[model samples]
Target: MIGEPMPDPRRSIIDNLNQQLDAFFGAGKSVQVIPSGVSADAPFFGTNSHQLKLRAERDKLAPAVRAEAAKGVVASVAAKNLRMHVKRVTLIAQENGFRFADNP
Candidate 1:
């Protein structure tokens, strides 16, 4: 219990981001196709959660996602930025059901 180390929240957030980027990033904004590979917008970050373990890894994805955005799509977002954006979006998703000290 006390001796057990808590898992990284960044890792958790990143996993959830990958899972929900479709909804969070908005429709028709995916940069890459996934799974079936039918050349459509999907939320794959050009990589996986393991690669997203550090700040450098998170920052490394910015350009690619931004490039997609420049092309009117959003394929892969960086982890930290993605995490921040996801929080903001989910807040809206919950219809302002959640709050924090900063918001209060």
Candidate 2:
């Protein structure tokens, strides 16, 4: 087992993000419906155990690998934000009587 190669840490984070987004927004639907009069101003970023583990393990990697890992984290966060924004925009547009082409 000692000879087994470990997986890239960034891939795990990306997978986790994708799973969470799918669970929230559903597969293939970038946007979700929010009931009338509900506000959507929740913040996205949070320091959690997963991040702490990444930070700890990151210190052990080479500088070049660490840099790449940081980029992965940034990209993952951006993708997540984009997904949430789609949901928010859809909810707002719906409240204003605009229907999505595919949804309507």
Candidate 3:
């Protein structure tokens, strides 16, 4: 049994961000639209050098994707931290039986 609360807001926020990323990257669809005449196994390059070049390009772009994902993770962590701080403050006030009454 994990000693954590159920439905953790942080996890939910992260999950939402990941879903948005999937939509952004089009992970649900084909990477490239193949023409009707093109077969799935068709080679993208006639030479190994061309294939290696494409692979290198993909590797270069991977870092940017990771950076974006890191941003989302940071945001979710910040939100969770803020929520926890607020909850602690509220608990402290409740324990002290503090009350605010506006008087004009």
Write down the lDDT that model 1 would get. 0.47
Clashing pairs in 3: none
lDDT of 2 by residue, 1-104 (tens): 79999989999999999999888777556776899667557433555677667555534433433342335443234325444344443433333443333411
Using all chains and alpha carbons, the TM-scores for the candidates as numbered come to: 0.21, 0.26, 0.23
Tell me the whole-model lDDT of each prediction, alpha carbons only: 0.47, 0.50, 0.50
Candidate 3 lDDT, tens digit per residue, 1-104? 68966898899999999988889788566466767767756665454677677556545544433443334443234225444343433333333444222221
Give lDDT: candidate 3, residue 6. Answer: 85
Which regions of candidate 3 are displaced past 4 Å? 1-47, 73-104
- Per-residue lDDT, model 2, residue 81, is 41
Summing lDDT over every window of 10 consecutive residues in candidate 1, give the lowest-scoring window. Answer: 95-104
lDDT (10s digit) by residue, model 1, range 1-104: 99999999999999888879867567657575466655445547644556445435435544444443344322223223345464433333233233222211
Rank order (by TM-score, best first): 2, 3, 1
Q: Which ten contiguous residues of candidate 2 have the minimum total lDDT?
A: 61-70
Q: In candidate 1, how many Å is residue 84 off?
A: 16
